[model samples]
Target: APAPPAKKPEIKAREGFEVDGQESDDLPPVFTTVPTKEKIVFLTIDDGAEKDPAFLRMMSELKIPYTVFLTDEEIKDDYGYFKKMQARGVTLNNHTLSHPYLPALSYEEQKHEICGMQDVMEKRYGKRPVLFRPPFGNYDRDTLRAAKSCGIEYAPIWSEEVFVDHWEYREWDQDLHPGDIVLTHFRGTDDWDG
Candidate 1:
């Protein structure tokens, strides 16, 4: 048998310049807070309305609330899956259109990406997301400002997140800590759910 791969920590690092809708080609550093006295965690899924039926079913049976960030590009195929889950629980957030790397695009481009998706989701499901999640956890100054102007207050990401089981099952071991956000994808995902 082959040796198993080394387990790397899946912590999302950010910079102080973490802004939304910037074209710096580099995500600004970030600031993260550790909750001192709380026992809760947040599990978030990325992309929109995946076609996988089993994952959808698993989501419903899990009986836990999760946040879903949608990029307009992902819904070009339609968002039937999302519309169904919206009724169940999954709260939607704004990702962007075409899943462009926000930090790599100019300020104007970044704003368009984030705000554009907000419009798409609102029009499709009548739900406007109040949170933003940048692709690949990357962001710069431009990214942040654009998101805030769009009514987003938080840059939601995983606290102690990882993919397990062939990278198919998205898992976040928040250890039941408060304000813990988990990250996952929808279509053609590479999460190991172990």
Candidate 2:
């Protein structure tokens, strides 16, 4: 038999891994969702509280509910305008105290923006919003943690958004789907007869 095999070199594996006190290794490399229900989906939109009359009429006519993540700045400019829709089952969520590029801000600053929105939305709306959307989709790890500090669940993120800023003829095609989170910066005065 070979001379006692040289004692196997002691091997060490990573004992633990954590970042920001969250287990780094325990987390999935990415987060994804699986649809649990057939054809059931949620619609979400962000920004624009600056007196868009056309969007209001369209929303009124459509008579379908959608969630809007509103910035404090946008709401402040005309915050009261949302109350009518709030009564109509439209969900209001916090985007930020003001639209800020959350990832670029320092940790404390990000916390301020995220928490500020949570605080104000609760005061103004009678409930703390459970959703948050980073302005311009600018977010980082800090942004996520800051949002969680308050009672916000991750808001919906979209890879594509259709902006109908102009009231063009094509907007009224009526082939819209339930899951499509349609976005329009402003609206036109007349209805497009489907």
Candidate 3:
């Protein structure tokens, strides 16, 4: 056997957030932190505008784990790129079909945006994601309802966003917590070159 593929390190789940069979009946568990004392943070990248091979190679070599929230419009052009990332153990989640502001849309419209993407994702990726992140970190009660109806179990917004040069914090203290979620994006050199 070819060295029996190396086993990846298992991620320790934060307290109060069981990794298996943890379900909620109210609002799909909106959270910004994982509620743990461990000095580990979750990485989430939103949008799929850039499909750089170099980025994939770097991430694969480093063996970093992250989730990607993909908008259909941006990623529909080159989903195979994402499939390659998926092969490397990245989880693909839903952003939306058009990246609309969910709060501005009606309940039906919100359902269409979310459920539509769910269908597309299932067809393309062979799995329906149970996690969703609303666009621009904006959503309302209806958005949560729509996500629930579409079978999403969690909705997580970032506590901070990491840019090429600096970190943007949502808290006044401007410090990172133990289980804080960090957000980034798929951008080419043009978007971050400045």
Write down the TM-score of every candidate.
Answer: 0.71, 0.67, 0.86
The lowest-lDDT stretch of 10 consecutive residues in candidate 3 is 1-10
Error of 2 at 92 (Å): 0.3
As for candidate 3, its clashing pairs are none
lDDT of 3 at 188: 76
lDDT of 3 by residue, 43-132 (tens): 999989999988889987887778899999999999899999998888999999999988899999999999999999999999999989
Count clashing pairs, candidate 1: 30
Cα lDDT computed for each candidate against the true fold: 0.65, 0.59, 0.83
lDDT, model 2: 0.59
What is the clash count for each candidate, in the order shown? 30, 0, 0
Which has the greatest TM-score? 3
Off by over 4 Å in 2: 1-37, 165-194
Q: What is the lDDT of residue 85 in candidate 3?
A: 90
Error of 1 at 156 (Å): 1.4
Q: Residue-wise lDDT of candidate 1 within 104-144, one digit each (tens)?
A: 89988998998888888888889778778888777777787
lDDT preference between candidates 2 and 3, better one: 3
